[model samples]
Target: MNVNKNLLNFLKSQPTSYFAGFNRGIEKEALRIHASGKLATSQHPKGLGSALTHDYITTDYAESLVEFITPVEQNAQTSIQQLLDLHKFAYQNQGEELLWPMSMPCFVGSEDDIEIAKYGTSNIGKMKTLYRQGLKNRYGSYMQAISGVHFNFSFPDSFWQAWASSQGKVANQSSIDEGYLAILRNLKRNLWLLAYLFGASPALCSSFLNGKSTPYPMQKIGKGTLYLPYATALRLSDLGYTNKAQAALNIRYNQLDDYIAGLRHAIRMPSADFASISAKPGDYQQLNQNVLQIENEYYSPVRPKRVTESGEKPTDALERAGIQYIELRALDIDPFNPAGMSVEQVRFLDLLITWCALTDSPDIEREDESIIAENLQQVILYGRKPDLLLEKNSKPIALTQWSTQILAELDDLAKIFDGDTQGVYHQALMAQQAKIENPDLTPSGKIMSHLLEHNLDNGSFGLQLAKQYRNESFERDFHHFTQTQLEQESKDSELRQQSIENADELDFDTFLTQYFGSSLSD
Candidate 1:
């Protein structure tokens, strides 16, 4: 059977089910905050596996920020179960610590309050910590402390072969790369809608500013919270990952080879702004003085990704084979869900991503990034303002109008996905439509309302949920994994770390020299 024949049926004349055999996973991060809502200063819990070698569990920029990664599952429900179970097990093992329930950290007094995650004595482990050290030195520790969820999805090989056949292309690396790159381009074009709908970090602890000055017209709320009247995800605003340093890189997304070349150039290019920092001091503050230490440092809402083997760089992996999947990094932590994302949210993403893959996408020119950045920042800053104007082909259009048009196209996709099930995709689309119609129903709006209605600041509100979720985690029994299995995995990970450390003979400096001088960086 021609599997891809009906993949685009939403836009074609026929009606057929789509998105079968889709593989999806989630990587969620949360700070291990103390009971009073202050970020925990403790090290990564020993019960959770080694942060360096663990496949399913790790830490992010801070030792207190634990990251849970779920294995790819065939459906959303199965994946959700795995995430929920992992959270439950972690809570059972940890003594008094609680996970922060939102994307933005709360009650941070100073940069010194957060601790950088330590990997081990091995060269690879030291490199991981050094990369994070570079992040801390370059961009303040306050920004690195903030975390977000990453959704990874990939179409099965069968779908790709069928899709290639339909497009009259060979089902090879070039064709697969072409298909995923189109998806990446379309995803960047429509990311504003995702922020508008699921953006929950509308407010944050005023202390997050670290006594630094900001240019936004932020007003103070109850007990030291800072927020705008109509902001969505402040996490994506200039206050967060959207920095001006890489704005001039002008990375384009038209071809796979071009994309790899751009990343390689970025790693090799020097930056005057960061040159003052130590490239290789006695303490070794950063990996290098390049614009980017490695390709992973370039932040984007979406990335065309391929899994790499031992010692391979991200770009090298794609250049070697092709894009295995595309990771979407725009989703904020859903404060309401214990897993930071809901099954319905996953279904909506499936529909939207597949829609993007099937739709035609134009190449992103050198100048297009600025336009895209402008639109995304507008939404991040004041997305909920009534009748907000956004750029469409360099002309102004109402955000509501643009959103409605996107939703209308998504409606057809919903129907196609709902052909067999109980119309869950259709239900998800309707829920999103309601958010477009009534901005107050959106996640950001709901969160903001709760804070104002209760006269509570961001920290207080986040703590309330944190306590509630911790109780739920303890009350519910494990369903997906046994306690014995998790503990054994943890012990096994420690053994692996010890083996890696014992095997290294050369000093860290010699190891780093060969790493950069190797063909991987070139």
Candidate 2:
């Protein structure tokens, strides 16, 4: 079948190193005693905790990575299977129901166990209920059950080429060939899912409620939870909208590169940006005040109400297209390696994108809201469970069986790709099968087993992962940055002199006025 090549090339052109935080190079630290390791704090550990701790960087990357897998599953069967597999795995890794230190609903505990219960099975619910009841009975609070896992995988591009270039691949005259196009399509679907997932934060939702969870304004929508869209910004209490407006101001005509970099830097909240903040042992309040100040000035968003339709705004390419890309925040750094993903995983993502592009997407405005809720619940709760029901179609099917069929269809689409006839969709299929044949082999299950074996605390997983990755990134990045600066000092002449001149002429007031003043000012 013909594919959208422009989108395909755009996806291919994305920097491969962008999502490396998922694989290896995180710092080794003593795991927290009672925390889940994924949360900002461990006070409340049963539900929504894992979802809350994800930082913006991981969320954004995850959302974008999905675009790669979306195209591969053009065949309806492949699409469904890929979706189901992801849902199953995500929930399995994250859906545990113990107190902050002891719960782990996702792990089956042993590789030898037979007939793993389906996600929606009574047993699954039982564990969640236990966690909830345990909390209410013990602490007078209730928690929600959850389904979703955070997975990280990357393969070399060779596997992608093999699949896209396989014999009998279809021919296309588009800027990008059929094979590459297929990969892009898969990525699109991933983008959607990741967006929805990252957006599914209760804290974010709470912001929409004006910081109050009124019983009437928000009826306990249903048993299912909400999943937000990717790249959607939240409104902070102090800052109606955010530095996004400043982001808009920074981008002057003829300065697109510097503008974009500046915006990223401002919003990223690096330590260098707060160099003046002190570390006095007794100045906790002062430290927090400084952090919050920075947050409001650089990290917060401008209220949508304040955003006039005609005003210039900071928009990435995707947002400009009326489609906000997903931000995947739930990925776990693989304990094993420096590279978070392998080429095979990337090819699989390509296949996924193809499926999203080729398959039918529900009309956002026309479709029932309940469809999204049901879809998320079913997928998260019962992924890979035999004879699972699709919320939209209300069809019952076996997830693994469905996944296999999807791969077969994806293989057919592989013919349209450029060179070799082999496909990456097959690898995804094999990976799924491996998990099914040996549930213990699944990444989530392994993580749980290891946690239990090591007696590591819960709630600490996410934070630990973040710290390690951050440390690794800082080590590598700082060294390279220092080297680059050194190199620039030796080679540059005119640019450096110009920079000095510009520094002398810098107008602090002008910078502030441009950033904080009204866009329509005379």
Candidate 3:
């Protein structure tokens, strides 16, 4: 429905080789749980490396929540293989702990039990933990405990050059920024489809409710398992990782300058909600009382990101260069997959991302913004519900009907990326189309079916998969990395952390001042 005819025509003429340089990476986070499925109390494994300076593995939100990052690669299979090898290494080093297979965490006891991630004694490291402290105080730790996957995708200079040429535009940083921003907008518009197809979190351990009430109608399966029969990714729902506070900021996404300015305002805007909860750095509850302590605190399903230099804020890096890649933060870790995602999923993402960038995207109007948001919320909470109607063009339409239309365009893209060969891209597209055709084939639907058939709670089901995947991971030999190589990297990381700690010239209070020095003071 949203196609830039000129660019689409241009891409059709160019050989598929022009798009061969597309790069990808994966960063997946999962909680470290014991065999009993309770959150692991152990610190991040010494064998995994320093959370502050490590290239691949790190901690997210909590000490038990481990994040695995794969270096950028051109081939989708290579990136997936790297992710698996990283998992294998982690299994080898993490002792008896198993990575929680689901995005939604269960059996996490009190908020006190969930320790904020420690990044060591470096000034920047302390700042990282304190920012999380702010998140804990503001949104609570349970929200932070939720785990998911981030797919980082970027196109090459040649691909962008071709697009700019077709549009009579120069392929400069500004154009590159616009290209990525367009993908961001369109991705948001279609992200619900992702939640519908790949969302595996249909149910969660009732412990996740924390005895709180939920707006969505839910049913109990086992004694403590709560679920919505039609739900997709509850992690995308309000009860999970919703960004209720950031809604007020109204961050603009149409242009880079406006996006940066919006972030600038949020970082500086004093929040009374946070002010009441926080103490100073020496006895700190949070880094500051601002709306966002740092740009990374702001959440979006899709974000145009740059790899920042040391000590540079994300906005500073963006302003200095341009968007390096777009990170898709919408994915829920598939419980069935050993590595949390499959090659087919990423290949489909390649097709979708390219289509989004090439599609004509205008500035989102206020009403359009609401429609896009509604689509996501509806899909996450009630996607598999038969005859579900989603708002589109300010009117109600069947979810499947719209999905079918989108898939048609994606099929065309698969052909473009695959040429005459029967390739993985087309296969990925077909796989998703099957999900659209058969609701039961969707990850969430399958999860629900297994829960019903086996009479298992979310915790029991998750533990089963976690154990199975752990066994499979151990059996999977490393192709990209070795035990010795990973051990050496971890040791080297410790040295790097020490150097950073030794280089600290100022106390954390002064460090915070300089870090926020460029922002407008409230």
**lDDT of model 3 at position 258:** 92
lDDT of 3 at 478: 87
TM-score of each candidate structure, all chains considered together: 0.96, 0.37, 0.98
Per-residue lDDT for 1-522 in model 2, tens only?
A: 344454345334444332231221111111112123222212221211121121110111111011112222223333333432322222222233121111111111122211111112122222222222222222121111111222322223433343334333432222122332233333322332322212112212222232334322222221211112111111111111222234333322122234344444443433333444442333321221121221223321111001113223443331232211222222222332223333444444445544544443333221333454344434333333335444324555454454455555555434334123344445554564565454334443454444446544323343354345434433443211133332333235334334433444324334323432432122
- What's the TM for model 2? 0.37
lDDT per residue for candidate 1 within 1-522, as digits (tens), equals 012444464235434433557999899998998898898898888888798887778998898888999888877887887888888877876778888989888789899888999999999999999999999999989998888999999987877876677688898878888989988998898888899999999998988897778899898889899988899999998788666777778776789999888888998888897888887747688999889998889987899998899878898898888899999999999998888899989989988888787777789886777788788889998899999999988899999999988878778767767764448888888889899999999989998888889888988988999999999988887777777887888888989999999999989988888877753355
Clashing pairs in 3: none
RMSD of 3: 1.3
User: What's the number of clashes in each of the models?
Assistant: 0, 102, 0
Global lDDT scores for all candidate models? 0.85, 0.30, 0.88
Q: Give the TM-score ranking, best first.
A: 3, 1, 2
Query: Candidate 1, clashing residue pairs?
Result: none
The lDDT ranking, best first, is: 3, 1, 2
On a 0 to 100 scale, what is the lDDT of residue 217 in model 3?
81
lDDT of 3 by residue, 18-132 (tens): 6667899899998999999899989999889898888899999999999999998887778888888888888988899998989999788889989989999888998889888
The 10 consecutive residues of candidate 2 with the worst lDDT sum are 56-65
